[model samples]
Target: MNRKPADTEPVTNAPEWTVSSLSGALKRTLEDAFGHVRLRGEVTGYRGPHSSGHAYFGLKDEGARIDAVIWKGVFQKLRIRPEEGMEVIAVGRVTTFPASSRYQIVIESLEPAGVGALMAILEERRRKLAAEGLFDESRKRPLPFLPEVIGVVTSPTGAVIRDILHRLADRFPRRVLVWPVRVQGETSAAEVAAAIRGFNALPRAMNGPTGPVPRPDVLIVARGGGSLEDLWSFNEEVVVRAAAESAIPLVSAIGHETDWTLIDLAADLRAPTPTAAAEKVVPVRLDLLAAIADLARRHRGAMMRLGERRASDLRALTRALPSADNLLAGARQRLDLAGGRLVHMLGAGVRRHEARLAAAGQKLARLSPLVLLERARARWATAAQGLGRGFAHGIERRAAILTRAVSRLSLQPLRLRAEAGRERLTIAGTRLANARAARLAAERARVDNLWKLVESLSHKGVLARGYAIVLDSEGHTVRTRAAVSEGMALELVFADGKVGATAQGEGAQPATRGRKRKSDAAAPPPVQPTLFGGGE
Candidate 1:
């Protein structure tokens, strides 16, 4: 049913609503409109994964920011952990928080909006820190062999502390100074960095109001494992710089072994977990005890050996001791016995001498012939002794004679060699003369043969054999018929001399210049017989 407006002016009729009513209606409208929104935004002012397992953070774009929450159930089921400044796509219902009087997204599902974007940001930041040399392996320090006090920069009330403390207790315990700081949030990175610098600034030898200004020998910047965004605080430039610049040997234990952050690279040593960091900081009590026992055993054995060696030396010294009187008495006894033996040996020697003399007397009769022979040998030796003078004289005379004969014989040998050399020289001279005569005769015979051969091959020889030699007008010999032509003046070389004549062709007649000699016309002159060419 429609009711009419009750007003003086019926034309101005608008419904009125209370503020609470209007707000409620508006909230409902928003919830219905975007009941399940899949919004993509970068997380801002993220502060949760708190004790209650709920996340409270703001999602913001360049234009605006809205409150976002992740309930325990939703967060537990999320594949990625929430972190500040992380871009994420949140699937949830838009609901109004009347108490805070702000509208927020009650997130039912959350995921990394863009892995590529996240990784790109991560890599960029990584390269930036690396360029600053924060991630250099050389700049990292070694963990203290045994830090008296360990300063940890982390959440004091978190499981990370508990795990570290429990592990320290289990292994070799140390005095741990917990510089409690929020492990995650917008300001977490700054707070953590401040804590690290503060620990470094502590006096090593002085006590402070809080018991001691703990200058920790080693530092552990640790955290429970989370997503890359959740662990981003440790990767922050501030946090990484703090870790790298620490004088204390820092041990980075950010997450599980698989999880890595920039701090891990910058730290001197990186432990896989808080517990492992505790384990790495010091050695086990039982192991130290075992080592001490081994040392003690070896020391005791060495002492015993030394004592035994000293005892052996003492025993040998004690045995070397002797009484002076006893030594003198022993020497006297030995001397008296030696005197008695000497007297007895002398008496025995005299008896042996008498016995040998009797035996020699009995052997003398049998050796009488040998004695006669010795006498003869002595006579011969005496003669030989007397013959020494004569023997030397005879040897000298014989040597002189032999020397003279040898000298003569040496001269005869030289003279005989000279005679033989002279005879050989005479024979060589005769042989040389005979060889010279034979060489001359052979040379003369070769010359004669060569001359005879020359006479047979001469041009006079050819003319005498009835062959005429023809010469051209150039005074050149025309051996071939082709060299002369008809009407060419040529010289005809006969046996006696050259005759000038005219060349004629084979069909032309030869004209006689003058009458031939009577003897030449009758018959060719008979060849004269001679031993050589010119003579013949």
Candidate 2:
């Protein structure tokens, strides 16, 4: 090989490279040789996650297998998780692992190969979240026209935040709180989710210690535009759920206009870009001021036109009105004519009224006040006498009542008290006498009733009523026919005496309870003629 000693002092025998140096050279050669390349293969043996957040897996086709690794950053930015047997196209540079003497592609970006695998996963998640009403239009809140304190959840160092702040400043200066978070990579989804929740959990009012952060009236979750892989954190379920559940209105400015994430659908509002989100939040200050001025101008012009129109109308009315001088002249003419007539009429009327008044005065004078006064005085005297008599009667009656009351009151002393006791005793005696008399009356009445009952029940009484009592020879009463046997002797008692009797071989005849029967020859009642020609 020919060597030239020039520009760089001759490269000394290609510099004896050690193993580390050789590996270094190979790594650089591989990286530069491959540059950025895309390859498609099926993922295999993807066990799960590593504590360091890197993923190790195998990419294989039917013919060959190669170990592959994705660093935490690149793996987290992947739209869909790498599952075993998924076909993916990875874009990255080839690098070697010195210990294992193996080469693999360090995936810078990854996607489903010739397939909508990520899209399918995204759609599935969307459907699931939508079913849960997370994406409901009804749940979407209206963004506040101007937030008091706007919270931003994004990478603190990104241009997105700068763009947002600049736009907001240009439109309307607002109080903004930045919740610094990772916009992409492994912890980005979790950090974004945590930031959203933290903003929501902040106290609404800051009277006391507001702690490190005050609650935001509206939250903006934003990131700059990139590949779907770059925006994958926003699509994460945790991030989307956090956005959906935020009571504070959330604005999703996730990426450029064409880039959409799950958070965009879940947020209260979606801005095409971070700058656009700022614009959406508040109107341009100058524009608002101009609008106000225009309204004021319109209002003033309207008022002026109204006032001019009213003034013109007033002028037209004034022109149509009769002159004050003419009105006064007409009124004066009428007043003059009426004044002369009124004066003439007044004179005539006064003369007539004066004549009538003279007559009336003469008539009134003919009536004597002395007569009327005398009559009134006479009536007054009668009324006065009556009133005096009534007063005297009332006084006498009152005096009598007072005298009685005084006399009664005077008697109610020692002697009167003793007399009252005696009176009470006498009253007790009287009540005792009345009670004895009532008892005597009741006893006499009872005795008289008993006597009457005895007399009524006596045999003499029964005989007197034409009834008899029968007795056996032994003097026992035979009350029933069955008790009287044939040939048995019986005794009958009457009010005056008793008689002996015998049963003539037959039971005793039943005594008739009524008076002797009276009978006549059979004869029918005479028939009477009916007025309707029927015999009765």
Candidate 3:
């Protein structure tokens, strides 16, 4: 790859050049070479903008330095003025003066490089912290509007502490716990983090008996305006994380209006300056008083409106109301009429109810069961006497007939009947014996046939004849496959004896298929025979 020539290399190789010409050439070359360049260095001698609308400054570090200038137009555009020891970026053309044989940059635009670089770094850190959900809006805590005890983390003697105290005193006159800490240099961030943690560790009820204790309701991390490097401690990751992780809400106020640091992004709130942070932390006394007066005025107005509405309603209601004299007169007339009617109706109802009660009592008296029963009992007694008489007469008639029957019987007739009875008994005995023998034989045959039928129908007989009669524990015959499910114990009755067996899967059949013929499915399902035979 081809490379470009170095800037230090001479443009032309000529030997007939004078010292002044060489210097002029070098100055021109330098101007051409370094035009519109941006250089970063620490500000050493920064002169504030003059009436000529120009700023003069010298940027230097420990090892190297440069002279810089910025026009008034550019200086006016800066939000924060440059100060000595401030680091800055100078965008200008590098030009050499032949008289002094020195090169300097004529700045068209100037910015504090430290602030820009810090801003860039803060932006990057913000993105990373946001990705980690540390700077998420959801993670941000709302500051208490009326904090009982406000905590301040700042330098002990700095303007930030004084401003916060004055503002807090003016706004609420509440005790602010100033956790003194360095606001700059190496130990500032550590001290700030420790102060935050310390406040957070305090018990929530630390406020005194009559007043709210020193538990910080809100934390203010503040510092006065300074160079970027002077304020860099607040931008440290420890400080940012501490502020971000604080249980109490944190407000970051570092440097001036143009300074933005990583701590600002991590904190719940960011204020431009310490005084501004204090102003944000609490309401101004005058503003609060004015607001209270305004609210009181609004409240009074609202009450007046409400009272007017109520009065209007009352007027409407009064207009809608009936006249008291008329109403009372009408009510009196109604009451008089009602009283007269009520008296008449009550008297009539009483009379009517009395008559009805009298009639009911008479009817009840007429239907009294005691009188009816007495009468019935008398009739029953008469009927019973008549029945007794009839019974006596009937008994006497039967006795006469029996006595005549006895009189008609004679000894000769009795003897002939006795002889005839003996002959007939002899003949009856022979016939009875023959008939009994035939009947016994026939009964034996019938019993044998019945036994045969019963045996054929019996579950024991079926099991003996190469058929199995399975029954469940309840003695219900297992007719269908499903009735004899696997793992079921069954009674297998044979002609001679009975055996218990369990059904395996192979012998089970679905009950649904045999549901139609369920009645004839098994041999009477094994039933407990009663002594009298089948169940009644």
Candidate 4:
């Protein structure tokens, strides 16, 4: 079925198109492919409008991107200048130029993609430079407090140079040698580096020509605000190294307050702007003059005070001369008096020491244990002799007394008395035996009677006589019938046995009532027994 339709149609082989025709179609296709396209990307290598009033740069994303162009007519309408690495949304028409046969977007309008992209780029660049020791504190040089001459490197035709010049004039008005250099574009980094080296290499005299001819004690690199790409010359490694290696102290002033460049870190000091760099490098003329005047006044005041102090010191010294002489004479007299008193005291002390030494020697001799022992031995010998004589005398007297006593106590009488005493002792011993036997028999009878009394008083004897003691559960004897009710269980205790019994039908009540009735009758009153078994 398809072959039948092909036969019905006419076909011929021919040349397709001309080069121009193909190119035209290609251009149209390319235009249609990207025409009126909206692109979001960061701007890199951004060059602002040139004399031709055209901006050229690349628009890039994370993966890929393309080149872009904007004529001055459209660029001038932009509220904010586009900077490198600044993400932007660009609305433009795509076109392919016939000359180069290249495709690009001709931007009509643009706005920031977002602020985050700029911050990210800043942070990334900071990290990269920081890792390379470009921002190391050790690399920074110290600026001279009062530089003899400041070398300025900046655009010869820009507000940056004029601002710097005016500020220097207003401040120290010192001679500043200008190193005219391009502060932007391709050759900017090279020009700035050359300017730094030139200043550093100049001799003191050649730096300037008259009136304290300028010697570059310091160098200032200055620039005005622009896009990141415009200010990129300051961030170039060459410019950074030049500033770091400069023999003269360098100050970096690039862009606005928020702009940071690698050269700023490498320089001795970083100023917010070109005008600030000039102000930082020199002191104000009026302020310095005032400071000098104040110093002079202080010096004069100090000199006056010093002169007054010297004069007062001289007067005091003149007055003190006579007093010093009097003090010397009085000191001599006091020394003489002190010497006499010391001699008298020494003489008295010598006598007192000698007496004390003699007393100490005498006490030492008295306290000697040998002397005391010798005296004690002599006393002991005398006491022994006295004791012997007393003992001999006492023995003689005792002998006489003993002899008289013996004579008084005759053996015949003593023997008779001893025999009589023996006979009496024999008789007494016989009587004592008889009395002991009778006492023992009497004690046995009293023991038997005590046993019988104890048996009669024993609880067992009472039980044997058909009497039972009732005790409560606590083992205390119940003395009265009222102590336990009719239904209360009671423990009856004998001498050797006990039984629990409940009071039934009040069996003891009649006995209690009969006793009460008998007590109520006018019978002879029953005597109560005391604890000692005495009738009361």
Top of the candidates by lDDT: 2
RMSD to true structure for each model, in Å: 43.0, 41.7, 26.1, 37.2
Report every candidate's CA lDDT.
0.76, 0.78, 0.72, 0.74
Residue pairs with backbone atoms closer than 3 Å in model 1 (clashes):
none
What does candidate 2 score in Cα RMSD to the true structure?
Answer: 41.7
Model 3 poorest 10 in a row by lDDT: 522-531
Per-residue CA lDDT of candidate 3, range 391-470, in tens? 56765675566456556888577557656655765576566557756755764565455456556655566667787666
lDDT of 1 at 176: 88
Error of 1 at 297 (Å): 0.7
> How far in Å is the alpha carbon of 193 misplaced in model 4?
2.1
TM agreement with the true structure for every prediction: 0.39, 0.41, 0.43, 0.40
lDDT of 2 by residue, 1-536 (tens): 98866786845666687998888889889988998888889999999869999999989999998888899977766766777777888888888998877899888877777537677667777999999999999999898876888999988898998998999899999999999998977788989999999888888665546555568889999999888778878888999999988999999998899999999999999999999999998889999999999999999999999999999999999999998998899889999999999999878966865675576556544433333334444665575567558656765675566556657676557346546655765675577558756755764565455446545644567899877788764444566676666777788888778888888755556444312222111223233222222333
- Over 4 Å off in model 3, which ranges? 1-123, 170-172, 207-213, 301-309, 324-536
Q: Taking the tens digit of each residue's C-alpha lDDT, what string does model 4 give over 1-536?
A: 43566568878798799777877898899888877989888898886667788899989888987888988878766644577778889999888776677777899888656556545655666677779887788877778878777788987888888898898888888767889998876577788999898888777665335544446888888888988767767876678778877888889899999988878888889999888899899888899889999999999999999999999999998987776677699899999999999999878966865675576567646644344444544665575567558656765675566556557898777567656665775676567657756755664565455446645765678999888888754344567665555666679887678888977775444222112222222234223222223433
Judged by whole-model lDDT over C-alpha atoms, candidate 4 comes out at: 0.74
**Which stretch of 10 consecutive residues in model 1 shows the poorest summed lDDT?**
527-536
Per-candidate clash tally: 0, 0, 6, 0
- After superposition, candidate 2 runs with Cα above 4 Å error: 1-115, 207-213, 305-536
Q: Candidate 2, overall lDDT?
A: 0.78
Quote the lDDT for 108 in model 2.
82
